[model samples]
Target: MLRAEWTKIRTLRSTVITLALVFVIAVGLGVVSLTSVRIAFERGLPLVREDFEPVTDAMVSVLYAQLALAAFGVLVICGEYGGGMIRTSLTAVPSRGRFYAAKIAVCASVALVLSYATVFATFLTAHWTLGKYGPSWSSDGAIRVVLGTPLYLTLLCLFALGVGTLLRHTALALTVVLSFVFVLSPLATVVPGLREVAHYLPDQAGSSIVKVGQQADPVIGPWAGLLVLAAWTAVSLIGGYLVLRGRDA
Candidate 1:
């Protein structure tokens, strides 16, 4: 079942395109950002030393690349439903639980591997561009950022998958996921009184893992923030499972 699921995902042209975009957008933009920062520092832009975060600045592209990853997750199951392939898949597997598990496993595995590759490529590109300014693997918090990048992306992918499963519509799922991550979360941070609540949002909480220093008035530590994001993912997946099991494929 897992093998079948893998084959289905691998055969999709959009999957290839989306994953390629993830790599290019992350590495390409990271290199550009690092280069620009290096130029600015060399020109004596008076940038605050205390505010400098080479690690986080180098990987700034992840914010944009995540949208592509989210779309990939949505396309996985939603595409099947959109094209009327779910019925055939359900017929072949016979057990919805087994089928859903296999699908989630394949999605998570692919997203994790691709995300790691993107993060590593971006890190190397930044190192090349920023030279001394870039964070090395042994640098403080570097390992955590590198390892957490993929984990963060994988969890986001799974969260999108769960939402897609529940909605069973590509446009609707993408709208909800994208808006929540890109719109509502950011809005909450700038709006007074909502900032505290926003700190616990899936995207906001997950972002702590990638940051290198203490955040201002942090609601949770890096590990705790990851746990919070994981909790959200678990809830989304459980909700999706319940809906999928109860509904006709």
Candidate 2:
């Protein structure tokens, strides 16, 4: 059953297109950010020893880039429903539980692979660019930034997949994911105390794993933050599965 869903995912042009777009957007943003940093250095712009971690820029890039990838993740199942193909899928699988199980497996696997690849590429690109100046790749926490970022992105894709399954409506699912990560969380920054709270939000928590640069008021450490995000994803996925089973298809 999982194999069948995997085959379906691979055969879809949308999956290919979305993955390609994710790679392009992630790499593009990383390169652009690196370029800006280089240009600033060349111009001798006062390098304010600002607390804004360089790693956070990379996190932001991956964050926005994943919007499309997350949309694709959602579409992996919801698209079928939208196209009426889910009915055919249910007919073939007979049991909706097996059908959803296969879907969750395939979607999570594909999302992990594609997101990891793109984020890894982005990290390498950014790392190489940062190296040309100073900050040796061997510098403290550099290795963590290079490696952990992709894992963060992969988990985020999984989280988005869970939401997609739970909502089952493309626009609504995408909106909820994006709003929490980008809109609501950013808005949270406006409230003084809320900024700390925002750090526990899915994107914020997952972002801590992306780099070693410490925020003055970080809500938690790297592994802890990722775990928090993972807990949210797990809860959402389990809830989604229960809902999927109980709700009429």
Candidate 3:
């Protein structure tokens, strides 16, 4: 089952496009971002307290990685439905549990590899470009994004997969997942009273774990933010599983 799912994912054009964006946007934007920061410092412009995560600033490409990875996750299963392949997949597997498990496993494995490679590329590139000005690998934000970004991205893929499974339509799933990753979360953050509420939503909560020093949201710490993301993934997966079992393909 795992093998079958892997085969399906690797063959898809959306898989290739989305994963490539993960690498390109991460590395490409990291170079642009860090170099621009370096230029700003050379010109005597000062970084404000609110945006003072040097390590995260260097690896700023992650801002875009979030969406690409989430889109990849949405495509993994939702594409099958879009192309009228889910019914055949269910017929072949016979057990929705095994099928869902296999799909999740394949998606997780691929996400792990891709996320690590993308983060590492951005990390190495930032340090190389910034030289002595670069933050050490052991620094708090450096460690968090180096370690946590990949995990953050991987979890996002799974969360997206779960949402995709529940929705079972490519357009709708993409709309919802992209909003979750991009639009809605940030909107909630900037709103007057919902700042605290944004702290717990999946993207904002998960992102807190990646920020340097994380001064804004006093409530959640790095690991706690990760747990919040994990909790969201768990609920999404469970709900998706229930929906998968109760409905027709």
Candidate 4:
């Protein structure tokens, strides 16, 4: 089942284009950020030393890349539904549980590989561009962000997939997922009383894993934040599976 799902995923043109965008957007934006830092140094712009975090700056491109990843996840399942292949897939598998599990696993595996590679490339590009200003592999918590960030992205793919499965419409699913992650999450952060609550939003909580130091140390601890995101992922997946079983498709 895994192999079959993987074969389908690999054959997807979006898989290639989306992964390419994930890499290019992340690395390109990271390089641009480093270039700005270079400009600042050259101009002696009096940037606050205490406010800077190389690791965070280096991975800044990931913020945008994550949107692409989520969209790719949405397309994975929604494409099948949109094109009416889902019925055929369901007929072939019989057990919706097995089908859903295989779909989730394939999407996650693909996201994990692409996200890790993109993040690593972004980090390396930043290191090269920033030279001594950037975090090295030996830097405290550098490895953690490098490793944990990809995990966050992988979970996000699953979350988006679950939402896509439940919604079963590409446009509707993309709108909900993107708004939930980018719009509502950030809105929750700045609205006084909701600030603390926003810390637990799926993306906000997961973002803690990528914070390495005082620059953006999260209210929640790294693993705990990831657990929060994982819990949300679980709820979405369970709900999606239940809906899938109940539906005619």
TM-score for each model: 0.95, 0.88, 0.93, 0.95
What lDDT tens digits, residue by residue, belong to model 1 across residues 34-117? Answer: 787888777878653666777776678987899899899899899899889999999999888899899999999999999999
Q: Write the per-residue lDDT of candidate 2 for residues 1-249, one digit (tens) a residue.
A: 888888777788887787788888888887887777777777888763455455555545676687777777777877776777877887788787778777777777777777778766776677677656534456556667656666676677777778877888878888998898779889987888798788889877877776555553355888887788889888877877787777766
The positional error of residue 232 in candidate 3, measured at the CA in angstroms, is 0.8
The digit string of per-residue lDDT tens for model 3 on 1-249 reads 989998898888889888899899988888887887777667777753455666767656876877888989889988988899999999999999999999999999999998888888888888887766666787666776788878888988899999998998878988998887578888987899987888889987887766776443587877788899999999999999999999987
- Candidate 4's C-alpha runs over 4 A off are 46-50
Considering summed lDDT, which 10 consecutive residues are worst modelled in model 1?
213-222
CA lDDT scores, all candidates in order: 0.86, 0.74, 0.83, 0.87
Tell me the lDDT of model 3 at 120.
82
Candidate 2: stretches off by over 4 Å: 47-49, 52-60, 134-136, 214-217
- Which residues of candidate 1, in runs, are more than 4 Å off? 46-50, 214-217
Task: Kindly report which residue stretches of model 3 are placed more than 4 angstroms away from their true locations once superposed.
Answer: 46-50, 214-216
**Which candidate leads the pack in lDDT?**
4
Q: Give the higher-lDDT candidate: 1 or 4.
A: 4
Clashes of 1: 0
> What's the distance in Å from true for residue 51, model 2?
3.5
